[model samples]
Target: MFKLIIMCLKSRSNKSGVRCYQNRPSSISRSDGRRSRFGFVGGDIGDQNMWRSRPRQIHINRFPPSSKVDLRAALPKAVQGSKGEWAVDEGPTLRWGIAPVSLMADDFAAALSVLPEQHHRIVSCVAAYQSHALAFAERHQVENVYTSFEDLAKCPNVDVVYISPLNPQHSELCHLMLNHDKHVLCEKPLCMTEEQVTKLLEKARARGLFLMEGMWPRCVPAYHYLRHQILRNRLGELQNVRCSLGLPVSQGRLGLYGGVTSDFGVYGMQLALWVFREVPRSLKVSGRVNSEHVDIAADIELCFTRGKRAFIEVSAERKLSNQAIIQGKNGTIKMNNYWCPTRLITEEVDFEFPLPGGDQVPPTHYHNRLGMCYEAEEVRNCILKGSNESDDFSHNESLLLANLMDTIHAELGVGEIADRKQIPDLQRQIEKVQDIVEDPEELASETCRVVQDVSSGTLETKQQEEEAPPRSKAIDAP
Candidate 1:
């Protein structure tokens, strides 16, 4: 029932790099004839109809952190103290250094804003996009904006680095951070291959430093509740798991290394693997691969040896309900936005509705949505306890995820970029910026000389300090 139309120019690539043609959508129409603040249209009638027709349901149960179960028991034993309790309180307040500011970085900042002041502090911001980073720094009041990633990596006050750059640069940047002995909490899809994950994780382990993929859902209370139910067999024998997450972006292309599977399919895979706690015996996949050789839409089926199956669907070309359902012999668990689940519903029926006794978890404002802090807390606890990786979302899981995705790409013929290094050249660009910063006086004269050589063309400058509009677009996850 939810509908969105995205207009995109045909994508083209050569030896140079991926080139995306941009053209705004000429019209956005909702069936109910309503428009949002961003001029996107939507309708409540279609939403209500879709919900009423759904087989399962979801409910939000609100509970304070104090009422929640002890997370220590769910975490790895290495993060436990002498009494087998989490040593969360023993650690110093986490000082975060956010690099390569973008939309996701802003999301992290929003999540950090709600955390307890004593638990965390954002000490610095490092930006490669000069214009955008300068604007972000002024808005967030971040005083230290370093041009060099090395500077942020070496800053003694920066205990951890939150890497939120584009996908291609994740591996290189993470390697850089780990080489400097800085704990890292990187954005999802940590790297392109399991080999990369293994290498970086090995480095973290060697240094006795903490490193974790920012899988926030795994750390949220809602997911914890679901995990308890599955582990306890509250849903009876597991039968099937289904997940869907779809959205429209510029011409339906996520980026160079981004498509439906890389950008959105990871959520479905993580959910399935976490629930089953086992790898599938076989996998079957079919999808639409775009001109750029990235999956535009994917439907994957993973068959387990125990007569169980998991079906996952993801896309960057349309809008879906964006929910997940786990089916079992006795009942089903339905999760809305399973990637960042805020609601959970247990229904004890195959065809009949109206269950008698079922659990419904209420949502917490910060914990449910902007809950990156939950992962941060886990990282802090692990660091204080001297653990190298989180048990909840361990390196093994990351490797599994990467390997699974790699298989999907192979089957779909989602060929790797011919010149992958040319795409998302953040490292190269940042090096140039760093060089300019390291020798500002010489670069200034050089810049003036270049300007003088350009035929004395007058440059227009706006003196008024107008606030840059907030970037509302959602970037594909790394």
Candidate 2:
């Protein structure tokens, strides 16, 4: 299933480097998220396994190692506010090259234009569609357009690779690029499973390539503003912090997703990971996962330093909620859904703290900076200055968030399922059924007749069908 094909460059060849391409077993079917029923070559299907309806299979790329390097030595340590757990360094322009990533072309185009000094520009992009990549490259004046990731690594002029592949595709793509000696900037929830993340991080460290999870929230400039305001100590000792962000889940678009956590919980987990001023000094979190999968919608409470607390609630079940409230011993600041507070309300000794303006008005100096715009600036600044990861979201914290989410799912009575029983059919004696993925044609097929095999009068069931192999749960004090 896996192999390493080594490539070599000739001493006098005009080509700068060797490119590796491993055609996947099957091409990803590009349609409205539909599964492809590729010509199922009838092989020796196990007598038992063949009876089961097949789930969609994902195509994957295999890579060969042409070269290797020790990655830990190349990292740099720079910014400091929360403390120095990560050593991010500062240096000069890194001729940046991106691969396997693209988002709203206009946003990325403008950001690249705003960047002051990046040595070289080369990128290989993948989107849901090729036209999307073409439009972005044409609009942004980027010369290269690569449809596949392997071709991107082969580009002679790349330094750093950006990975924004579809969620499941991330871990492997990241390793492929890092192996090619390029720094990486990858989008959040980089990989769904914890094992994938740990391996990616370990590989990045081993290769000495800069790798960061692109959790844009951490890069927003408002963080600087928020940090200064809090450290200014104007609000007195911070007592409790609460933040919530919710949007109408378009069931039409998101409902069929089947994975509930993908929508609502991903937002809260990402925000709660970064927004709070301090992580739990001692944290205990628990929540529930739907029977469907780890598609969870849950609440978490974090007890922080000095009796303070942080509460985070998320659910795919609702449509609208956008409020961040930071309450102090004396006053409270209510932030609009995803933005900094349009108004700050302070209190004193169980009474409202006096305002500079009228009762409904805030001080004359509140600013509303475009958030996403600022995130791009942060990425540019970090790359140009040679900082490896976003301080707001260090490489380590991203993994921690995934682990916490998993822990929360387990601690709660999430995996609970009731017993199943056979339903005797009026026409045929009996049948048993559990939830419900049916195709109209398949419903009429002989496959439906197999339901009688489980007609045992006594009900028997198993909990937690199976999960990927476990990861090392090495928890350090938060």
TM-score of each: 0.66, 0.55
- Cα-based RMSD of the predictions, in order? 24.4, 25.1
Model 1 ranges off by over 4 Å: 1-90, 348-368, 417-472
Q: Tens-digit lDDT track for model 2 on 1-478?
A: 1223223322344222211111111312212232111111111111121012222111111111111211112211111113433232334444444554343223333333322323224344544467876876775566777777777777767777666545556678888888787777775566655456667877776776667776654444333333333433445677766655444343333334323443344445554433343333334555444454444456667654467676766555453344556666644544433332222222321111111112222111112222233454455555665666555566645555554444454455433222222222111111121112223222212111111232232111211111121111210000
lDDT of 2: 0.42
The candidate that wins on lDDT is 1
Question: What ranges in model 2 sit over 4 Å off?
Answer: 1-106, 117-123, 127-129, 250-291, 294-296, 339-373, 380-387, 411-478
Error of 2 at 187 (Å): 1.4
- Model 1 TM-score is 0.66
Worst 10-residue lDDT window, candidate 2: 469-478
List the global CA lDDT of all models. Answer: 0.60, 0.42
